[model samples]
Target chain A: MTIQPAFQCERLCIDLPGAPGVRRIIEDLDLEVGRGQFVSILGGSGTGKTTLLRALAGLTSHSSGRAVYEGREVRSPVPGMAMVFQDYAHALLMWRTVRRNVALGVEGRLRNGELDQKVQNAIRMVGLERFRDEYPWRLSGGMQQRVQIARALAMEPSALLMDEPFGALDAMTKASLQDQLLAVQAETGATVLFVTHDIEEAIYLSNTIILLKGSPAHIARRITVDLPRPRDQIVTKELPEYLRLRHQLFEAFRHEIHA
Target chain B: MMTAVNAPAPAVAGGKERPWIFHAADNVWSALQGLLPLIALLLLWQMLGDSRSPYFPPPSTWAAALIDRTNSGDLIPAVLVTLQSVAAALILATSLGVGIGGLIGASPALARCLGPTLEFLRTLPPPTIVPVAALIIGVNETMKLFVIVFAALWPVLLNTTLGVRSLHPTLLEAARSLQLGVVARMTKIFLPALLPSILTGVRVAAPLAIIVSLLAEMLTLMPGLGALLLMAQRNFNAAEVFGLLTVVGSFGFILNAALAAFESWALMPQGRT
Candidate 1:
């Protein structure tokens, strides 16, 4: 079945101020994301994977090109778009309780009872109903990232942007969060553009993987995941298809490292 | 690395039957260690004043005078006056310092441009300005508050600027991605992020507040603890001077403790623990 483009980026470029002069971060990038699809952007450090996601969220100002979302030009982050950052400890405000953090995603922008209901539902969805009153610092790394995901989900955004959301967790925690994130994305059916440096993670979670280059990041490659949904952490990792995809992505990363 | 030393000292309770006696010994040992410097100072005073100098009084004589002052209430009023000056200075300095600090901190370009000039102003000996302040504002409460605010504000201001600038990048990105407006971002993210640093700066500035308040009063001959100390000096009341000095030191200690308690309590609600 054909799907409409949830977002389209045309020749997007980013120039950042530097010590000597302005540095070009990204130049002339084009991409498209379909509704309910999970897209991953993979890049080495200094490549503009995160920057590209930020541009999509309207948090970064591009020197050129356009990010069209649902036939509208993206200029600022609105209800239709939401972002989850790396370093979950800082992503959620230390001062806000878990419930309040989720509430913050929807409150004042939505009707009163509806906002409350959404917050509750998101909390339950994240399996953090028991910790609704606890602060972000009290949560484990994986749990805190879950709260961040829940906050994004609570907004009911059309497209979700996640930048290495589980990057700070231990390996075990990272695997667990990967499953939980895929589950959430499946349940919500929100289009996702997630960025990461881990090649295996990119393949395991993404429906479409976009590779980025450094020193004025440009699209290096694109790979599609044809794996079945409702994926399991243990079974999925052991599968032959998963192993093949992992080897392919790792080879690509190895090339970048060699370069 | 520290485990070798920290490993259950026999003196710790619940370790052994002898722990009660050892715990008492430990308390006494630490208390004696804290008092070692005071004991040394007293010994030096006694040695110096062994019928040779009028400038230095023995610790026993200072203690006697301090006890007498407690009975007489004269020292009490003088101490109270000094404390009041410190309080007033602290209030004025905090409000003005934090206000100006927040303004400068919010504007990084302005802070960078004016920081050196502010540093120069802060480095000037605060006492030197007392006479100028006296001439302009006269030797009044206003002069004392002015000097206190002027002299003590730098640490707070600089700290605040540093605090605001020290915001975690993830928090900032979160705020922006959440679609918070500029004013909402400032109130929610900037203020909260800067609070710890602001408290640290205020802690650093507390002693400055006391020093400037007393310095201003002494230079301008205002009726505060500094003037009281000066009066004691002129009368050659060595014991009274020592007594007043002790009071001033204690007051500074108490004020700092209070501020520390407040800092801990305020930050506690934010899950700082």
Candidate 2:
């Protein structure tokens, strides 16, 4: 028997309310994400990448077509699926402590000791154990993003949807967080659909990259990275294959821009 | 990263641990500092006023009149009646305001529909309602309560509506994504988020409630401090009039302080540091 895909979208389209009537932000698009696979949706600023991610998470309603998760129609947010937003500061509950924020997804479902254990485990996974008692506002931007990730992790979702999770972070912080995210994905073995505008980030993190282009965007290209497991930042970037993939992604983006 | 290290510690939890007594002493010292200006003003009043004047009495004469009223057991009961009325009105107004405000705020259509009506009602002087209430309900506790509620309900309702309307959309999304039920959404998310604004409305309303209650009492010749003040004024008992006014001022000050303390205690958990 064959295993089903984690998420499948068929001709998904999104029309957001605009001043002049409904505006199409996402055109008919089809994609499938396998379990335990790390896929990055790369696009320019207005290419509807985030909209696609949101639609997959069931946070956005598709104007046409369907988004199916594990054979279930995703009309609304489903259980066992978590999302990490880009604006971590607003995404996190500043009133809550780090542990409380992490526990937000699971507190209502889990019991006392089990809840604490899960919260601690998630925080530990994100290397934020020491800051558990601190408030989100007290933490750094990168730390705040980590707390958000920890919150998503505590849900123990089958699939994690992230929309440019490290887009707002400093370059150094962004690099470190990218590696941390890789470690997390490897440990949990959960399917990840990461949305980012950065070509290099998409190349570095994704096993499969879906490039979105055009007005009311649709998938323009799909490339698979066959790089070795446990990828290193410094070492992998120096490799010939990694460099070639990066160049190809750059060319794809440039072509999209020019076209 | 560098900003995080140099950021000031959270005011709620940071700093060296101090004994309970030290904190209490700090509160007491601050309270004394607040009272300093009042004390100075009273001293100036005593130095300037003539004891024998019918229009203006000295501090000693006012003190004597207060003692006389207290000895007769009239002052305490009057103060109690006024306080009870204000307290009852405030409780009723708060519940109604929050409930109505939440409903109106949650629906933009309802808010827009009722906006003009609410604004018109709010603009009508609260004291104007006192006589109307007295005429309709008769001179009684009900009349005072009606006046107070009519007068004070607007601020709390308006503030709560504004707060609810301004709630972060992302927070609502977060709540929905977590699959929070309606009850949990209201109690855990909506209520706490709307609390600061609710308290602000209550603060404004509390003083208004007291003022309206006093106004109702004076206008209708009801039993309260307001009635006593009006009676003293009629009798030309300057000392007694001044003494009652001073008591009313103190009540206002105490109410304000108590509400402020409650606001801090309730909001501290939300990390306003």
Candidate 3:
């Protein structure tokens, strides 16, 4: 039996209001994300990668074509999908404690004790049990981002859309968060559509990487990683397969820049 | 990395700390320090003033007059009447301001259309509005309320509108993605996010409400502290006039302090630090 795709979009186009008239941001794009798969869209700055992620999340309206989620049209945000934003400071409610921020997504749906349990479990999953009662503003940037992720996790979403969730963090924090995200994805089996400008990060975390290029950007290439699962940061990066993929991605990015 | 390497030394050796009682005493001492200037000024005035002078009665004479009024049951009633009017106006103003401001703030087109007219009306002085209100409502409780509400409403309305407009777009996105209904979105999201600004607006409006109510009472010869002050001044009762002035000033200060306390308490969850 063939498994159905979690999200599918065909000939998707988006036009934003600009200086003179409308400017096309995404043009004639086609993509599909499979169930329980980690897919990353890699592109340089101004390639509309974030816009495509927003479109998939139903936050932005496409100018034409259709975006379907499990055969249902996605015109607005659906309950079964959660988005993790890059700017955790603005995305996470500063007034709420770590556990309370995590509870934001599940508060209306869950009851008293059940809500508390889910919030605590989510916080523990992100290794923030000690900081659960503290405010988000008091924590470091990486911890704050974990709070946001824990919030998404508490929603019990079927799909997670992340827009460069760790782009602001330092190297050590970024590596640690990347590993944590992989572990969470493995445990939950949630389909992830991640947008990132980092090529190595895309290769490191994603099962499939979609390269976007050009003025009104469209998918230039799709590369699948057949590397073994339960990958390590030190061990995985040193692999011959990982090195080959990195070289290929570098060449592809350089080609797009030159073109 | 350098700081990280050196940070552990302090972490390992950190033991020196002050006792909780010392901290509490320090706070009390600092608060008392803030009142020293006012205490010194009052003492100097007491020493320099003449008890017999009609123009410059001593501080003791003002205290005696205050005690006399309190005993005769005039001052308390006058203060209660003024407080009641101000309180009523504030409730009305807050309700109208938040409602109208939220509506205008949510829509850019509405904000643009009403912006100029609201700006002009907001700049009109409270004394000017008091007479007009008296002319229309005839110097009653309703007229005093109208004047106070009109003067106090603008700060709240403008601040709330600006606050709502400046809310981070990501919050709205999160609310939408969570599939929150209108009521849930308002109470859980919008109101909590806009609370700090709303409290700031209330802080500004509270003082204005008291001042406007007092001004209205004095202008219309209404039975409040303002009228008492005017009557005392006209009768050349310097002690009573000064006492009433002190009372009014103290009342304004107390109201401001109460609102500030409320703001801090309500916003405590947000973590001021």
For TM-score, the strongest prediction is 3
For model 3, which pairs clash?
A: none
Residue B247, candidate 3: how far off, in angstroms? 0.7
Q: Candidate 1: where are CA atoms >4 Å away?
A: A18-21, A95-97, A100-117, A213-215, A237-254, A257-259, B1-74, B269-273
lDDT of 3 by residue, A1-259 (tens): 6768999999999888889999999999999889999999999998999999998888999999988887888889987899999989888888788887898878888789999998888887799998888888778999999999999999888999999999999999999999999999998899999999998899999999999988898899999987888989999999999999999999987866586
Model 2 TM-score? 0.92
Q: What is the C-alpha lDDT of each candidate?
A: 0.80, 0.86, 0.87
Candidate 1 lDDT, B69-173, residue by residue in tens: 778766777677778877777776777777778878778788888888988988888888888988998888888888887877777788887776667777877
Q: For model 2, how does the per-residue alpha-carbon lDDT over B1-273 read when each residue is reduced to its tens digit?
A: 111233333443343223233334445468779999988988998999777898888778998999999999999999999999999999999998999989999999998899899889989999888767778898888888888998889889999999988988777777777777888778877888899999999999999998888888888878999999999999999999989999999999788767776776666556551
Best by lDDT: 3
Better of 1 and 2 by TM-score: 2
TM-score of chain B of each: 0.77, 0.89, 0.88
Separate DockQ for every predicted complex: 0.63, 0.55, 0.65
lDDT of 1 at A17: 89
Winner by DockQ between candidate 3 and candidate 1: 3
Cα lDDT of model 1 by residue, A57-170, tens digit: 888788999988888888877568889888888778788889988887567678888888999999988899988887787778888888998998898887888888888889
lDDT of 2 by residue, A93-157 (tens): 77678998898778888899999998999999999988888878777999999999999999998
- B107-200 per-residue lDDT for model 3 (tens digits): 9999989989988989999899877777888879988898899988988898899999899998888788777789988988899898998888
After superposing candidate 3, which stretches have Cα over 4 Å from the reference? A255-259, B1-32
Best-performing candidate as measured by DockQ:
3
